[model samples]
Target chain A: MRGGDAGFDEFVRERYDQLLRYAIMLTGRRWDAEEIVQEALLRCLRRWRRVPADNAVAYVRKAIYHEFLRVARRKPQVPLDELAEQLDLEDFAPAVVARDHVLVVLQQLPPRQRAAVLARVVLDLSEAQTAVELDCSVGTVKSLTSRGMARIRQLWAAEQAAAPGRRGT
Target chain B: MIAEEQEYATRLREELADVAVRASAGQVDTVLRQVHRRRRDRRNQRIQVFTAMAVVALAVAGAFAVTTAGEHAEPARQVDATTPMAQWPARGELAADKDLVARAEQAWHSYRQPPRGPLKPLFAGVSPNMSANMVVVALIAPESGQVAFVTTPIRVNRPSDPRDRLLVRAVAPVTPEQRGVGFMASRPLPEDEPPIDQNAVGMALTSPAAENGKVYTSTIDSQSEPSWPTTVVGALWPQYEMGAGAWNSELRVQFRGAASTEDYTLVTGVSDDVDLGPVALRRAGAALRAEGPGVRQGDLIITPNGVVGVVAAPDGTVDTRLSELAAHGTVGVAISRVPGRVREVGDHAEFTATGPGDFGEEQRLVLQAWDEPRLALTFAKLAGYEPHWLVARTAGPDAAENVLRLGKPGAAKP
Candidate 1:
């Protein structure tokens, strides 16, 4: 295969899903998130020849993250409930439903803590990788992840206490 | 509780796995198409830039060839200061299209004058040989010494001929000092009116030669009229008798009084030509007949030249011609929020005025509705600014008839 075609097909097959999932996590809104993903992918295609083959996925993921942040910043502040409404659960499994609930709870944390939690839990990246991705120290990333988990636990415990009969469910 | 945290992490991993990474069908294609279009546009732009550079290079080379071939080219040709170089080509010819003239004219018309009388003629009747769509007129008040320049966008239906459809695009105000000399009016003060003070106002006239030479004295107290028919002492005052035949002349008058310590001057061009005198009056009359008596004072009569003739009436009836001139002189349109007490929900506040001179001329009208927070909020997010939702449902003949959505930052009703 020619260099450009080989690069393009490989990028689509390898990184398309991961970028879309990241975009969905960032924007909450399905259609807008999809659009952000598409834009980032196109930008990647334009600079495909220049990107190192080994770090192509990382580069595209960063592009998606940046585009998501840009759109979020430009948009007016939406209520947390309105953001939740933008999420779709048609194909959600029990695990997916739990994850969605956790995402809602996680949003209450500050932006840095939320990023740390998403990187560690959702992305399953190492603490050092999360720190590098977030442009913070590993120690800071560890502390933020710890605090984020604690906050989520406290919120869930309060909810369970408020509803005694539905504890198992 | 620790097990639940582990479960949450597992669920997040499952959800991330379930998340689809691929774009919707054709989305990639669409994006690629957009990229291709942008690349094509960039390529076209580059070709155009290269072509322009090549043409310029060729022209320079040809000029050099001509100069080198001719021994007579040794003596550098001297050009008159007023007349631009013909062989070298005038920048005005290249830049002076219908749009440029229209833009210049619009700018001249939209120029904001200090709270004072009409603007003087900047220049009228471009050289017949020059085919231009744009014309800029600048007027400076001799008394206040405030200068106003307007550039208008114009569309010339007849580019080959000097006279044709001269549609003005937009009028904007420019700095006064930048306007050429002889564009501003200067006048001597009358002794009886008041002593000339440093604060006295001066004016310059530009258009309508009939009103050009006449100088008007501004009085601080509306009740106090200037003592005219006194001896014209100042050397600035040239002796010229008003001919029985209709003549177009510019007059500059300066006044000083207790109410206004500064010299206040008014410059206007008067045309003894009867034909032009009543065009504005006749138009205003027609507007009154059609629109009924909504026409009041403080409205503007915008001319094709984009000159704003304001309607000043302390009384209901605008009977006096001099009052008309003083009120409607070339000046800035004043836009202010309607008194909130007078404004109510669902009710649009309207202001109207008659033309200054003839009934045939077009009158001015402006309507503003109270802005609703909800509507403004929705549009503000989309537009990036709170836009003033004012609609010009109806305008006189010369006014632009489009529904303009003015952004709040630099909102002007005119």
Candidate 2:
């Protein structure tokens, strides 16, 4: 890692966007999600030699999750409006709004549960993989994902019900 | 339910797809440059914290595993709740006793995890003015490396009213796990010439964590108003229970400068190196076999059901997995005797150097970095281990140096 800036650069270029997406799931705010990924990347660079090359992506992702857990403890139950303040709301693109609406609900899930859902579903990690990333057992992944998804389903359902016409999409 | 899970997964991927880093390449490069600069600055600002391992040449030094081997290990629960607190030294006691100050610095700030109940202070008495002063007691589960504390007032450690015997009795042994605390004079690393030595102070003890306290960061925040009482002493004994985290058990210490109003908290965490994968449960004879949970290099495992069974293993590996009943279940607790508290037990005391290696290199670095390598050697001496070769392999590589035994006293040997 002493002279490995090149590898670090390439990792950022290829994985930054992907890492951001993962962060969004863990941290509802785009700003915090990006910040977590960025900080993790910096640390990844510091301990670069110790981390196996094959596990770089997973390394950063796990760091993101751990960062979320630590940050979650520091700032408890963030309000949706405060999260909104992190964004430039003028755009209001439907994709952005849709993500926003869902995040509002997702924010209600515990940090661990949110990380579980993102890993199992969005990131497409298996129960074992999710467990490893989140530092829990496979059984825990199942339970967290199950409970988290159940809540998301309920919220998604309610959202659709309110805007039946918009639900067509 | 599986289909529903898949549906939920699919919807999330679609909805959250747009989320990505928008920072331009130039912006990113700038950030990296800034990060690199900060790292460089920190290293430049760094002081020599044990640049050389005070090399002392001698014989009769090799890596020794003086492990108590659990046979004689006392279950923390079974251990007597004796108060091990050091008496608060008088102002005269604060006079330049370099050796005693070094001993206090070397004392293990953290003790082994005690079972939860209520904590008894090694010995907490009133300050010179009779403002009650007590040490905080914390429990750490060796298996989980999880720590919990019996929160107490700075002035009144367990707050026992003279009339409240029942209250005191019920809370007498609150912690269920082993317990310990670190008492360094400086709460933080001083940025001056010798960042290694905690700012040589008159008498500054750490203030416990509180909402009304001024200690901001968990680390890198030290404020010791060097007054008298420098040769202070206190110990953490179990009194009450503070539960462990399911995993990622953290060690938290609240420190306040005895002379300053603000207090700070320092935290570190420990967890089993678990592996989780498509392990097929198999039994070969009386013993059950599974490719133990190293699922992958860094993936974590959690039990589906809340219960995790602790299994007894000759080596402390399979304790945090599923039990036969909890099986097909992730492993659970298999309690065994873990190394307990390090206190004045005759001429020797024990300190758990969990820096990342079985040897004490990392711990040495931490102590030395915090200006306490001499403290490590001092503990080694207290434990009656010669200064030639010691090992703290369970800690980290930085830990390798911690356990090295350098040499004999004045008697010279090659």
Candidate 3:
């Protein structure tokens, strides 16, 4: 499935939502996640003429994840002033206030471990498939997901104990 | 799947569904527009570069130094350097095949040339590893200085030449020392010990390191010469064990741009090629592609190289998630409510309990001024103790809600 611009654009139209969601999970902030996806799509379009259709989806998915990783790797985050500057750029962000108890805990996990749990347990990707995506061994995926889940449970319990004691993952 | 995993998924689905980020149709439209505009701007910059070079060509200029990656490097075909980057047709994604094989396949397709015309590839099998400073074949668009024939980022690894596969078909496992553990009390060499001399053989992997020093299972053809260093180094973090000590420790697997090795040791198998060849590369690619660029933020990918590494491509993605986490990364997980600012350290910090009668056995302390949420209330005490054993009294009122840690702090995330 080589991707021509038409096909590539079509791909973007279909998966933009899912990609955005994945990016948001990868990056805690929405605008940054959106930016990452857009950049990935652009990279895809740049090579649309050459991208194999079979590989385009994987390519973009890789690009999105990589983009998030790259952004996450950037040194000491922008100061609070810069954060405000970015927040001010959003024209209308009504959902910004809707914070989740689980996401707060999720944010605390090692980025890769967090990604493992999401890709494996939540998304139900096979361990082998998840390993391919994570560029690790089956054992690593097992270890990461296991540790990640345990941490999630601990964090969830902690969050619940602090607040309303809601049952957690 | 385990019951815990099932339970986690159920809880996760419910929570994430309730809070997954979303965007409006307008926002999506804007993204599409902006990204395409950026692509166009990039092409336009290439065109501008060509124009600038042409203008410089007209002006007085000194002879330039020729930069080359290899001693016998060949020059690319020179063009007028006046063409726009967009004019040159972009050949699509490169497949996993080598130059000779691609040529062979191209020749095979000669008679089957698409009904359209003679199948002329602008070029074939551009190495995924090539970049600006070290391009194998330079195709600067006419005069624009824009790279017309950009190299692919994915290396080409074709199937083995059957004869070569027969060379070491009966390969056995490596040793425990190579596995980094069985021999010593610990697998990792003590931090005090000097590092191994990686350049023993002169191979890039054996050398200090390469950009993104990722090791994949590789084999170097053994040399009869006495000067030849052993291809088998200690095992670094590898995709799988070929046996023990087949490769060097993970710290020894050096790559350029790679800060830390992911422990994927590239085994130096006995092979026809002196260094990593098609077979090893194909295996590496397969393994890497299978392992998704080892989860960036959390997406799994397969590549010896990180998708977004410490060094990013010019204008590539720049993630700030981890850095932000590093800033305000922790919290007081085990503590009860804010027991004021208990300034203390070690496995446990004893705070004066004004509320021993007010609170239960468990107690908490929150600190201020840090982004990390990990400032856990670290303390352990017997159940029926009376008040008076308090070491430090947390003085401030709202300061209890701030950031602080009490206990032997566990290693924080990088």
Candidate 4:
């Protein structure tokens, strides 16, 4: 019934869907992503009294990142075949196939490199912000992103060379 | 120019714009409902804690106020009483002494045969005119442990001054073994101090035999860490139930410091065995075999440099010297444990080694397994940077058998 509780309800209603989408992108599984978002929101609510109004979204995002890291550390290895199957290439256009192929190649990189590339490109965060989120220096993030992209390009070229008929793009 | 690269990047981003983010409507509802439930639960917990703290504060305040009023009234009453000095002093001292004796007795009684089910005070004592009172009881279950309690005083007035009368009572279990270890007062360390760097200072549970019940409070020390200590009192039993086993399990207590980073206090037993699921074992074995000297199931390899030791089996898996092996390279030797079985192409294998070798040093070694191509390479030179000496395993197919040098800029050619 308090004014603060009412405000929190409003905040949750507005950002729940967006946060869920972000979590889904990060985790690559709907069930795990939803669980992560729900846990993040609950944690945010517990400390709502101290959270600054301006940075509420940032706090929620940080919580999501922390939860993701916790789960990733516990189960670091993912089955390659399962991950490959999860990438639905049929949804892409001819030009998009090249990009999808690039993403598949990106998946082959180490976990840290893949995380850096996604945080930079897919999430569109600044280099400094991505570095802070990863608890690393900006130089490390830049290096990882560069190396990750180079590997993707090499794999794409190799795939194109091997499959001549599918190289229309 | 770099502009062309940037343009290509922009096009790549736009092409992948349709990556769908999908979750079922039911899933969303479930998550939202869980969030709401947790919020409510946490709010209720906070309210309960605040309420309990408030009650203790009020009781103490009330007791202090009543004691002050009694002191003021005593002076006025003294003038009216024309009684003899001998009678007055003896009565006053006797009453005080009797009260102290009664409290001590109550504390002793509460220690023995603590009540089961809900917690309750076993003994209650109130001062004359009911101005101050005390109750003593055990807090937790007798089997789990014992906790003592003392009540706050009821203040007559002047609550704003932050002074209150207090009635205190103490209770402990009858048997020394049943009684919980008493509280250890600790001073907060500096902000920069590690949370759990020091040895445990508190009491530890002691078990006599494998199946016997555990006794509490075996050891106590000052200047110890905050978390409780658990002593491994017995060896692993052949057959024991989960959670009731006397198995040699490692105990770890984690503490978070003021900086919000967690530090762990770990204790290890001499022998410990943990089951790695089939999938994990298979993956680990494959990763190990791909990177180092290939190992098949049941084959043993003894390294000449005292670094690598592995036993390989026929099932395309290797049992390393240790369950977790630190990464290092040295001129050690490996022998095939499997007598007749041969390592074929495309087979997943694992190699493990143990030793006091520098992780950064580059060294050459030969790998000979039955029926497999002979392997010769310098692992440190091939793996790029120095491998972590504690545990490092990589997963990939076997590269070519020629000299495999590590730390090359590009991928090493098989």
Candidate 5:
């Protein structure tokens, strides 16, 4: 289908959520991730005719990734402080706390390392496939994942110890 | 270590397994509307480009005729010291792009001004790379002596002509003293030194041995570049990668206020822009509101749950604070019950904190204080047998006064 064709809307409707989740991983902010997804969808919609029918998701995902990188490049100021919302430690279950802690640790990784870890562990892609996605060498993928995993382990341990009741428990 | 890493990976996978976000009700309609607007903008830009080319052609032809008649051709336009900056003619490589100028003007009008009235285009630069083509526009309101810089990513629809997508990233206010000069640094260079002279547009060189360490800051007087307008914008292009020897380095430009020549410094990092990922902090909706003007670095706002650090914006205004912080900012607050004590031991200090279960006596943390007020916790290790190490402890002070004292030996409690 051409740009703005009937099939285009259907494709977007079906894959919007998946695209958003991936963007969230890339951007970290829901507002930014949503904006990125919308921007990517528009870009893909414009060139729908060229996108491969067999791999429409991959094409759109690539567009989202590039858009995130583009937005990142344009923003070249000092790093802002991330404000952690007040949370009652006693209010949550152990599972909820564990999930939240891991997610928090993921944010501490650099973009390339985050991407590598997500591809390898989350998506379960082979090293070669991960390299193809990241557009880097397989060796670079290995390096990124290794460094990423190491950082995550260190961060997870620190956060666990820091959490009030979790340490003694 | 391997088993712990695997455990963390397993948890990460489980945490993100069901991550999903539903598209908003009008997402499709919004995108379609944007697509139509983009098409219309491209058509209008083409017309504007043609009209500009014709006008330029006529001016050049007219100037040639005057020169041929044995008379000196008059300068197209001249500005005297008496003329206000807003009335000054637009000048820059991208000043000729009428569509961009119009978009910049529109953004400038809509953005929150800093006591400055109307601003006119001063200078612009387009930094094109494989990833994105970014155009940075500097607009100045001379009477108020304040300048605002707008950066937008342009999409080149056609190979020959570049069109403005008009998705203005941010319009940031630059003090008159800063003259709107900024730097865009690329990733660190490789170990093998490449020739800089061939591909360099501008260069900022600082030695590792310099008192400032990795971060190198310098002020270039706008008065020196008389022909280059008060605001000079330059980029350390992507192709000429800066040496990685200065790990996590920053390039700061000192702006001597245009009106009174007072020194004003802006600190910007030369690294990847970090975004707030989905976490309890962001999910619970921890929003940033400027406490007040002139919130200094390391200033903490104590809350019921934890501490919030105030990031210093170049100007004290809330608008500029949010705008600049949107790019790259760091705010880390750690409140731990584990008491950690640090005492100086020669050049480096040793920290003793409570250790966990199987770990022996005390967790010894060897810390180094960088020139900056920030304490660089070198590493934390278990003292006795089978020593396990924790590297790069970047958390904000848990033991506030002690941590501060570790970095600054004679510092009083905050």
Candidate 6:
């Protein structure tokens, strides 16, 4: 194996699950999340030799976010077909009681809102860092997270009202 | 409300932490396979382009020998190409050398996009053979509704090499002034067009030596809309499927005195060193011409995707003013046959301009500026609208200048 290939392969194996979970949080669908992570890793591989060893995980993480945003920007029809399969099979399964309520609720928000909320709440990025990651103004980040949090809260409340016996925090 | 929001935020993070989704088994191998496939595809594409260029170079060599062999030799009835060189008097330092001009014309016809067009040879000039014999031809492609200038390297007595052929120096929609200039030539601008005698500026055909390496940057006072500047730069066409980045889809042209090889394409085309962004050129829409009092007089570009707009600013900045005018109410495609109407784009529509900052030369700066079509696609994707690639025509010259107004399901034409 080429010197870089060994490192890249090892890196992918070690970080794949962590990256997949982060992608799922952003995309709200396992299929879309996998696609996003795969594309991001492929792009990262192109510059793998240059990525700082200590920061490779962060680099791949940022790449995943950017890839998700790019896919969202394209709004391509091909993925919506894949999305249909994901929705039918996994997202709305009878095991909704087992899935995280927040993950279920995140599907209702727009891509930017979800990204903003994830950056602020889950990744624990400050408003400025979120702005830089999302490529928007800090004020825009603030607005997106605020609106996103509100929607998630509303959805969580409605879901609790609908299925009082389901999982809730 | 604030306390509740913070509580929700905290719980959300906690829930996310509990969420776990693993990659499908052997997913790493799948991605590696895809990576290899993409690399193979890119290599194959480059080989195809190289093969085509090699064919063009070989063709140019044979044509040069045939043209120089006999002056009176009836120009072999040309097939599926621009106008034959026999029609125009060769007018440069190499004017005495008919063979050079003829070879340049042949090379240009070989390299031009949408090759079959009724041609009007505007100017032909040759610089004394440098590292390679350089020849430039400016002409009109009526079938495609564009005026273009192409540069090709001719190897007079050497073996054909694909690297020698430099194609598409400049091709843009013929502006009103060029239309008038073109009309002055034997072929008048197509009869259906309105008369533009007032805008026609007489053409000046200069020697290639005079223009060699001289850069002319047109200055626009930041305060006002520039009057017809010397060089007519327009965002020609965006080739989306060609590659991943907006760079592939976008071609910026300075079709006048600004013609030089120092543009973005020259830099990006030759070198694979510069990494590109993942943004794709999604769509090239129908031709939308903005004309009326106050409309920035420019060319009517006909791209494979569609006739987008006349990017007439000398700086090659798209006049968003036309769209901003339509934002108030009126919206429709200007071309009568293409049926579409947009009521209000509201917050969903916007024309975002990205500039390549401080690139020194205006041409480089111009080429890097994102044009309307790419903007339309980007905006459509970001706004979550199904991007219908059509630019709105300014309803009347009365709408505000420099704003973009697009329709929701349709595009805005004023």
**Model 4 vs. true fold: TM:** 0.34
Residues B1-414, candidate 6: write the lDDT tens digits: 288888998888776776654443344554554554444345444654665577578678878674654463333343211223223333332234444445545655776354455665545444221212234455656566655554453332232232244444434444322212110111112211221211111122322122222111111101112122122111011111111121222222232365433222111221122222211111224323343223323322212112233344432223333343223222222111111222235533332222111101011001111232212121111122234332233222222221221222122323
- DockQ (C-alpha based) per candidate is 0.13, 0.13, 0.16, 0.11, 0.15, 0.17
Off by over 4 Å in 1: A1-6, A88-103, A161-169, B1-7, B14-24, B35-414
Error of 1 at B319 (Å): 62
Regions of model 4 farther than 4 Å from truth:
A1-6, A49-55, A86-106, A164-169, B1-8, B22-29, B42-414
How would you encode candidate 5's per-residue C-alpha lDDT over A1-169 as one tens digit per residue?
Answer: 3444447767776777677778776655555666788788778776788887878887888788778778876755223235122111212111113233444556677778887898789878899988877889999999999999988777766767778565421
Expressed as tens digits, the lDDT of each residue in A68-147 for candidate 1 is 66776677756778756544343211112333444566556665676677788888789888777777799998898888
Model 5 CA deviation exceeding 4 Å by range: A1-6, A73-83, A86-101, A164-169, B1-5, B54-414
Q: Which parts of model 2 have CA positions greater than 4 angstroms off?
A: A1-6, A85-98, B48-414
Best by DockQ: 6
Q: Which ten residues in a row have the lowest lDDT in candidate 3 chain A?
A: A88-97
Q: Write the per-residue lDDT of candidate 3 for residues B239-306, one digit (tens) a residue.
A: 11111122221223333355543342232322211111111111232122111122122211111111
TM-score of each: 0.35, 0.37, 0.37, 0.34, 0.36, 0.37
Rank list by lDDT: 6, 5, 2, 3, 1, 4
State each model's TM-score restricted to chain B: 0.21, 0.18, 0.16, 0.20, 0.34, 0.26
DockQ of 2: 0.13
- The sequence of per-residue lDDT tens digits that candidate 3 reaches over residues A1-169 is 4535667656776777778777766665565777799888887788788877765666677678777777778845544445444333222243443443455566677778988888886566898878877778999999988898888777777767887646533
Deviation from truth (RMSD, Å), model 5: 19.6
| Model 6, CA-based lDDT | 0.43
**Residue lDDT tens for model 1, B1-414:** 267677656654555555444443333443444443334334444654665577678778887674543341223344222221112111111122434444444444443423244334232222111111223333334444444433222222222322333222111222332211221111111211211111111222222111112322211101122221111111111111111011112233232222321121212211111111112333465332112133334433322112223344433222322123222222111111111111111433222222211100112211111231100100000111112222121223343311111122212333
| RMSD, one per candidate, in order | 21.3, 26.6, 26.8, 22.5, 19.6, 19.3
What's the DockQ of model 3?
0.16
Give the distance in Å from residue A164's predicted Cα in candidate 6 to where it truly belongs.
3.1
For candidate 5, the docking band is: incorrect
List candidate 3 stretches off by more than 4 Å: A75-99, B20-22, B58-414
